[model samples]
Target: MIQYFRFLIISLLFVSCTDETATAEFAKGADVSWLPQMEATGYEFKDEEGNKADVLQLLKDRGMNSVRLRVFVNPSSDPRSGHCSQEETVDLALRAKEMGMDVMINFHYSDSWADPGKQHKPEAWEDLSFKELKEKVYEHTFEVVSAVKAGGVTPKWVQVGNEIPGGMLWPEGSTDNWDQLGQLLNAGYEATKAVDDNIQVIIHVDEGDNNEKFVHFYDNASEQQVKYDIIGLSYYPYWVEKDYTETIDNLAFNLKDMVKRYDKDVMIVEVGGLYDQVENTKNLLEATIKAVRDVPDNRGLGVMYWEPQGEKSWSGYSLSAWQEDGTPSPALDAFKN
Candidate 1:
């Protein structure tokens, strides 16, 4: 009887795949990049008195099953925006996990924002030698991920860097330095693996529909020995001058073609339809939801509307506009497929 019980346990373990494999099925997930704000006191969506809504419940109610969170290596010197600190991120992750949501970690590898136009090096990393910088990257990544895991919320997926086409960590690891870039990313991968081998390492890059640039960027990464599981894309219709239907169609075609060609699963890690009369945010959301549901060959894995509920107005980092009473407009209806 004991032997039979042991066999049953082994079978269960063998059949149950890791979170990475399970999520690869849908490529379906949401990036909850606003946890820092939601946890703050007296914070209301768009500063509306009644906007104290539970975002996680709302997303789950709408059929979202996973959440992605971005971690800045050291965020800004400012105190308020400094909340992506290890303690803050882990706290948010724990809450999400308790609510029965899967999580993904996006490593920006900078103290502040890291993107295509600006991938600045951390202040501390500015003086490090090449070898020292590599070591620091690995150490920092391991510590952050280890803290998240220790906090009882294990992320199934991790992005090495954000929208890094020109490369991240500046000068040394910047675009023209493929050798340095490859070394830096490998360090991040090792850090993630040290936490859990099952975690999927994602190499995220922007410019989804632009076949020429995407292909070129990825081919370069491949040659550099940057090991990763998922290829993440950031698609914004406004940037490409395409309508909602046209954008989704283009995304679907590219996704299917890329998967077939690269033999790698794809995730729209950062995607948003600006609700503020830009890119027809409303129409784009509707189309995106439909696209996700009817994604051809299951390749349209996941689409995360970037910071839909962030502070409104063009003056701040937030997207979207507000009504006189601070009511969030219908731009968010894009998620309601």
Candidate 2:
């Protein structure tokens, strides 16, 4: 009887330790880059029960512990695209910080969207030479990070460029020119560390399920010795048309392998679901969260829903978690886990 009791006690202690370790590690987050703009246009968000609530507070109540905001350098003259300028980004970051949520600042490095297909340099930087543009990247990163710190909110993470699968700063720093791209990335990384050494730097790219793409991008970045802490991926189900089960399994496998290969943490820094497909979207979120959480040795940091509050009329963005009435979709419940 004493031997059996000892075994039981050992099992109980193991379970307790496992629970505590799991609790200490995961983060639930959302990218609400359009929050300020949506609120500016009189959009209101309500809790699941229909009570009017502050969006940030509602998110916190729903178990989201982090928020990601994107910043553009000298945004376009158009009002819609101009609101995410450095000052506005700092203001938003302050708001998120006030709510006791960690903040991640995504630098697009352009006056507009900077993705794989379009990484247009800010108009101001268009005139600079290749060498000069590298300086600009460093200067921009340091300035924005400095401003965020000045606003009394030191971001927990900083993304050097948004979805740079092909690369950023156009032909000058495109993937075709891996050497220049590496220099620009290193510049951003160094600048971010200059402001705050503790801030985790991320290199974001789209197509989370494409393992080869990730391997290719990181292999080049590694070869060029680009410094970064996290591998951020944008995984949209609509973009990856494989069988649902296959897709999730592939993503999970890649996530684990990437962590082992890079020896760095990983995050689904950006993801979105169709507004009308609440149930399906919920499944996707649950699967994605699980995949990230399943990375061995706690290397899976978290997943962030991209623009969960963006409604059709607000920004014409289709992949929001908000219904037409401004109430959060059932898809958001996945974050509650």
Candidate 3:
């Protein structure tokens, strides 16, 4: 009888430790949304040691505990640009899950890149009425999330829309039309909850250093009663400010203030630096990570490098952390510390 009691206590302690460890895992993520497409084009990824390796494994070895993938409603048929469809996202997400990495599903809501400058409504959703558009947002969000769940992996985070600093499903859901934007975002949020009540739903916006923009956006969201769990920001020094130090300082200040103002967790969902400037990139990443870690009450989750594997030859995207031999740049070392 004493032996049985001892075994029960030990088992309970083990379970409790496991739960705490899982909860304490900070998100170190990479947005490899183009990995599948890149691999299809015969691109191979190498580790820092210059040895060929599985991209997902390479990232995991680099201290990346999570991955973010974007999904489009209906993208171009071209294999290169069209692979982010619902099914494709599910497959990629499943792959990440199998590797013991948390997954963040970013819904673009459009067929192509949806950012602050252009929030193009999906081609199929262009003709829908305001009411119909709201319904479409909910349906599409629910369908994609459901498919992801059905694929044997439930994403740890679900971003309702990508880089909607101004708003999404534009003209109708633009920032100026706060009411409609809130309604659309709420629809997406509700759909996500319906699929997985525990999943953290994020609302992403570009310009992490701009406290004013965040304040304006969240204030409006509060007024409209838009429900969400995380505030995702895109902080690119090259685009936001010419001085890297200034950008870092501004971002750190805003991150702290944003959490206090809105009382919500925050994350740098997108960030990148010039691949050629390896040292600078490393410094930028280190500073960014430190700033995020300093957020009060651990509300600052972590930073995600956007498309660090994007080779210029294949994607024409200049911002990458890969060398000519396809190995990750040394700048990635910042993630270790």
Candidate 4:
């Protein structure tokens, strides 16, 4: 596989491609679905009378080709409290499919949010050793995928774990323990393949524009023999503490190199900017679109505005704003080419 920075220069040489040539290569996708917590806070897919809401139709209408839903095995709190169980997610997935949108399942492998800072295993698997954990991961993954399939919705992509920068499932398979992490990832990969070899498996990480982190994570995963089909990144200019343009440029360049080196398709599975700051939001969104559009050919699979219209907005984690009666923000229009 191609290592990012080492081959950066070579990628720079072929960066200039005509728009027609670029579009013919990499198509676009989105990760519009929020996690369980966000969903429960008031982002209802069903109306008070139990009818389908227009959000699904709106996404399809707005040109979003895909919706990425996160699945949590189980949670200490109520399952619906921002941590999606198999049932809720599948229901959502089926709806997305019905709306003619592709779906991607992101297995957080934890009961709550799993990112660079935290990864808390579900209570049920907290005691498992490496081997037991691997088997458990496979069993859990298979069950989730199976549930989605049985519900009459097939996912186009499945992420093995969500932002596994410091490892997943905790203790035994944490990032510091590469051997365990490799086994953990493989468990999910195996399940995905068993269910359907065609569903692309993604290994996701945060800090999309950070070349060093991207290089380190991918290289370590390669050394551990972790299998994945897509390079998934989470990019948010508002959250990232850096000059937005430089960060985006670094990310675009890194993505091109990652595709060239890893031989995998790239997806900005999770991305968003603030809508409250109207001017800044517009600028940030434009920069983001340009960065994604800049990637060579099929390598840049485009981005999803992560919960752009989430309830109450990004200021708080509530789902109130996405309700039908709620006014849509200018953020939605930012993605238009």
Candidates' TM-scores?
0.83, 0.91, 0.94, 0.82
How many Å off is the CA of 52 in candidate 1?
3.5
* Candidate 1 local lDDT, 114-213, one digit each (tens): 8898888878788989999999989988988899999998888888999998898988988799989999999999999999999888888886777777
Root-mean-square deviation (CA) per prediction: 4.6, 4.7, 2.4, 9.3
By the TM-score metric, which is better: model 3 or model 4? 3
Residue 121's lDDT in candidate 4: 84
For all candidates, the clash counts are 6, 0, 0, 11
Q: 2 or 4: which has the higher TM-score? A: 2
Among residues 3 or more apart in sequence or in different chains, the pairs in candidate 1 whose N, CA or C atoms overlap within 3 Å are 26-301, 27-301, 27-302, 28-301, 75-111, 285-334
Colliding residue pairs in candidate 3: none
Question: Which parts of model 4 have CA positions greater than 4 angstroms off?
Answer: 1-53, 76-83, 313-315, 318-325
TM-score of candidate 2 against the unseen true structure: 0.91
Ranking 3 against 4 by lDDT, winner = 3
lDDT of 2 by residue, 237-327 (tens): 7766653456888789889988989898999998887888888888988999999998988889999998888877777877888888768
Could you tell me the lDDT of residue 149 within candidate 2? 96
The sequence of per-residue lDDT tens digits that candidate 4 reaches over residues 1-337 is: 4687658866666574544455542323455445444445555554335565576555555556678887877754553335477888888888788877788899988877788888888888877776888898999899999999999987888999888888887778787899889988988999999999988899888888887888898999989988989898888655665556658788878888888777887878777654455556557666776777777765667676666556554326432224344444445555555
How do the residues 186-217 of candidate 3 rate in per-residue lDDT, one tens digit apiece?
Answer: 99999999998999999998889888888899
Q: Which one wins by TM-score: 1 or 4?
A: 1
